[model samples]
Target: MAMFVHVTSAANAPRIRRSGIRAVSHGQGDARGVYCFPVLPSYTLTHQWLRELARFGSRGGLVAVHVRLDDDEEVLLGRYADRARNAQATVPAAQAVRRIAELDDPRGWEVFVPRAIRPRELHRIRTAPQVAGWRYRPDAHGTRPCTCFGCRVRGGYGARRLRERLPHPLDGPPPPVRVLLARVAAAGEPGDPVVLREVLHWFGMRRRGPLDRLAHLAAHPDPGVRKDLVWAVAGWSTPGVGDLLDALADDPRDEVREAVEAVREPE
Candidate 1:
């Protein structure tokens, strides 16, 4: 959420008193810091003005005046349509999603994404300044996960861990585990043995992977890694390569038994 500061009552008074307009600062820690733009008869007018203020296009007035959607508007108009529909709201107070019908009907918002945006896809609307940060782009810092299971295992750990365990090239100081984890997150399969094993090891670095896969590896080769991996793989209990896991479960290896016992505690 964005915060608007240095706001005066005059510029915002019209919309503030109309339509019971509200501004929510999503990033602000304190609720008291949230500014409520009261609704007025001139709500549409104030809304235009607030939009200008948010865009820094307002002429010489109300610098940094924050404007945000009320709880219902955010939930309804801001992509939480399912939640809004599920919520029982009065007609006037409910989200005016029906108004959006006008958008799809001939001439509307006209802003279509290059790809189909699913209902579950999160839509983040950012201003020019916010979008200027290329750091937020995917693969900007090479954080993209490797799709291959071997690559995922190697990528999830730093170059050092990977060098010790696997047959992959190790460049200088290892890339941060975050970059590797992101790669794994994007490409690592839920049930692949190498991906699952690497994910388990990576959790010790405080990175969690797909849970059920980790649970399947509860009887993995390494004991300590399994302990932390279990937490990451919580709520997923699907059986995996049972023969492999069962073998690890019955293995004479002390490390293997310890890890399996830790994960199978509640089961």
Candidate 2:
């Protein structure tokens, strides 16, 4: 009963079925489009199909297409959403990577995921309870470079230079290097300090430029943050940095005061 505006191939129909989508006859078209019954796959299967759809959609192909899911499909998406939130197994994470690779089309992969799952999933897999604590699969290491901002910033030219650069996870997160630093510096005054501190620390474990930004952050409002910034900057020791430290020589906070003294001390 539910029909596509365009005639679909029998092959495409099966593909949809295999994809955990069931076509339900809802007496015909609905106001939204076509209403089909949902095919509920295990959470793993749902994750797989979503990744596949995203990857496939990203490929420059076809046109703007709307996929109308039946009531069942909507319910399944919610179920998987819940499963994803509560997932305690690396199996789900590994499945995520496998499903993405299966898509073959990076553009399409971007099109289907939750934005977070596409790029960050690898990281999550690496650190999560299931994958991180248990095993390391060199195969699952994502030969493709992560397209997320964090990966680009941390990986630098190395990630770009690599032959395979995967699309970002659902088009967001792992923010770009410049964007991350700018937001960090702007935090609290016109932004949020917690977000700034979190990102700064995240950068600390990754690359170098973030430290340079930190040095200039001595003027930050939070004394503790300023102290951390000073420590990060001291690693680089640029010209006139000594003078900058000298200016803060009398800071009341012991940490800031010590940083200023250490930075200004004769070599």
Candidate 3:
């Protein structure tokens, strides 16, 4: 059997000790699982997720609840950089533990077990290294501002201004202002979001108008259109966009909510 650790707030320690970690996402609907890190040979790596969990846990000290799983148990594995549901691969529990141990530096990897960890599988609970792990993501410290708009903290101090000003090296030149406006004006109501989706890319946030023209997309039957609308509104400084966002925030689809939270102001 391979061992893993689930880092959580101290407030949860007691309940976990009594009942084991449940098979449930904290709140999200589809990410149902117990998120954990495989216990590796390196102590630093084994407990690397401590700090990151505690930051959001905000329930006093943090603890690592050790779990022992059968070698044949299946689990989802992925880079921590991706969203929880975006699994990179699924492998046996022992393989995940063995693979991480073999890697020189598997810094951003994480594991997710799909079922409840029974108390019998709970090996032990202990204080984890509070200083371990990365905040936000592994490359965040002293790195260039993340160019992927969805991944960065948009509401952080000066963030909106910074995103507006800087373009990543890999980005192609944005469309000419006149051309972007013309595209929006010329755009027709298509059943598919593909046409308007391309127009949003032309805007690139430099100019913020034509809100009335793009408003229909907010409630389009296609969720891709709704999500695209959220991304487009994120760049513009126009009014009515918030109302659009408010409507989309309540969308039933997980992808739509993910887009809304990605750009929505920090609450």
Q: Identify the superior model by lDDT, candidate 1 or candidate 3.
A: 3
Which lDDT values do the candidates have, in the order given? 0.35, 0.38, 0.75
Which 10 successive residues of model 2 have the least lDDT summed? 125-134
lDDT score for residue 95 of model 3: 91
Model 2 gets an lDDT of 0.38
TM-score of 2: 0.29
Measured against the true structure, the TM-scores of the candidates, in listed sequence, are: 0.24, 0.29, 0.57
lDDT of 3: 0.75
Model 1 per-residue lDDT tens digits across residues 1-267: 211122333454444434322444333222212322222233232232233233333333342233433224332222222322434222221233333333332111111111211222222221222121122122235564333333343433254554545433322223355664564566434444556445444444332333343344455444554444543443234344343344456656676556556656785
Task: Output the lDDT of residue 28, model 1.
Answer: 29
Q: Per-residue CA lDDT of candidate 2, range 27-102, in tens?
A: 2222112221111222232222332223223332222112332211111112222333542122232343344345
Clash number for each model: 16, 17, 0
How many angstroms is residue 1 displaced in model 1 relative to the true structure, after the best TM-score fit? 26
The top-ranked prediction according to TM-score is 3
